[model samples]
Target: MESETIQEPLDRFLVSVERKAFVMARMATRDTDEALDIVQDAMQALVEKYAGRPEAEWPPVFYRILNNRIRDWHRRQKIRNLWRGWLKPWSESNDRNDDPLEQIQDPGVVDPGEGMDRKASMARLEVALANLPLRQREAFLLRAWNGLDVASTAVAMGCSVGSVKTHYSRAIHTLRQFLEEYRP
Candidate 1:
């Protein structure tokens, strides 16, 4: 009975965070499967390692685990890319046909133009986000998208609050420049 009480709020918390965490991971990885795997790993790590902590502490802890997982994934990718580059002469061309946009569902709106505009705007925002440096992107997503405050974002990012502010500011400036043409 005590275990059930503990598990219920944890489950709710995970559910509430799942989609945004997946989006954050997806933006970082640019691959759906990798993003899903990272989010799952983060969730499992949180449950296994931090379940006993106070509920108020969960967000920063969970995000910290998630960011660590993302960083590790990037490190592994870099190593893999290095090996692939070395083996390039013997390997076939690495062409991928998967278009991330194709996976988006129709909004089912009455006005076709509205949906198209929304998609175009989203595409522009995504491009801007993808162009940011990893640290900047992480700061922006954690602070702006995830709604984590500066101190919590610093904790999640494993960085100082000043660093988070600088990264997030740079990310916002860069994004604004990139998407300036789309502004109304």
Candidate 2:
């Protein structure tokens, strides 16, 4: 008697994790459309690389690949910036004519029910977050937002547990300082 090996379980696991994976990519890129593309690419790579592996290995394997892809994307962006700097025209004006206030307004603040209405307050927090180095943001999001354990976050980040702890601690401290200053 021949028993068929079931692939259904692996397919189900992929489906379950896909949405969260997309959300993670979106946070890293801060763009929904780009995140969707990254997720699709990650899914295809996972199917090609790990679909034949044991179901137990799929989660970490898929995330490792996705993280590597995101890192590669960042590296390419940096290289492109360097090239743009070399090739950019000198004719462009350094002076800005646009109103800084227009760019500074937070739509989220307009609804006081949603949150505080202090424009400078929200801007301070956002600027603080943007200023954080990438690893810190990644660590904070993985641990605090995504609710991953330290060990799992370490695996996803391809870093030591201690490194993850350091990044998370710095991110939390920075965020706390920024938020405390803005507290109503």
Candidate 3:
């Protein structure tokens, strides 16, 4: 009874973030259904494992759970691909036209007073971000998109400050390179 009282706020917090968490997971997985499953898994894992932790700690803890699930999914996909590759070595050839940039089309609908040039810039930035390495992508999103500070990012990623710094620096450099090449 006391535990449920303590966990009610955490439950509310998770509910508030559920939609955005699904969006983030979808972007990470590029699969809507898989993303939904990941979000559900993350929420369940949080409730079961960390429900008693202080409220101040839930954000990073929630993200850590979500991140681990995503990584596990990616790993399983990798193994599946490896087996599929052995069965069909021509699978890579079938995907020759699936350029990442082509998939990043902006809908071209903008709010009043928003400039086309700025929209173009944002679309280009999204492409660059999509091309980032997985760890770098996660670090950038957790820090910039989610607005978590370095310490929180470190907690979420299960890494030291230095590794986060390295990943972030590399992400910035790679994004700059992509922007220069595409000039969008």
lDDT of each: 0.86, 0.73, 0.83
Q: Which regions of candidate 1 fall more than 4 Å away from where they truly are?
A: 89-118, 181-184
The residue pairs in collision within model 1 are none
Please state every model's RMSD to the true fold in angstroms.
Answer: 3.7, 4.5, 2.3
Clashing pairs in 3: none
Tens-place lDDT digits, model 2, residues 20-100: 778667656667887788888888898776677777667666777777777777787789877887898563545654532
Per-residue lDDT tens digits for candidate 1, residues 32-146, read 9999999999999999889889998999999999989999999999999889989785655446434534444453554577676776667778867866788999999989988
Lowest lDDT sum, 10 consecutive residues, model 1, at: 96-105
TM-score of every prediction relative to native: 0.83, 0.72, 0.88
Best by lDDT: 1
| Ranking, TM-score, top scorer first | 3, 1, 2
| Between candidates 1 and 2, the TM-score winner | 1
Predicted model with the maximum TM-score: 3
Off by over 4 Å in 3: 109-114
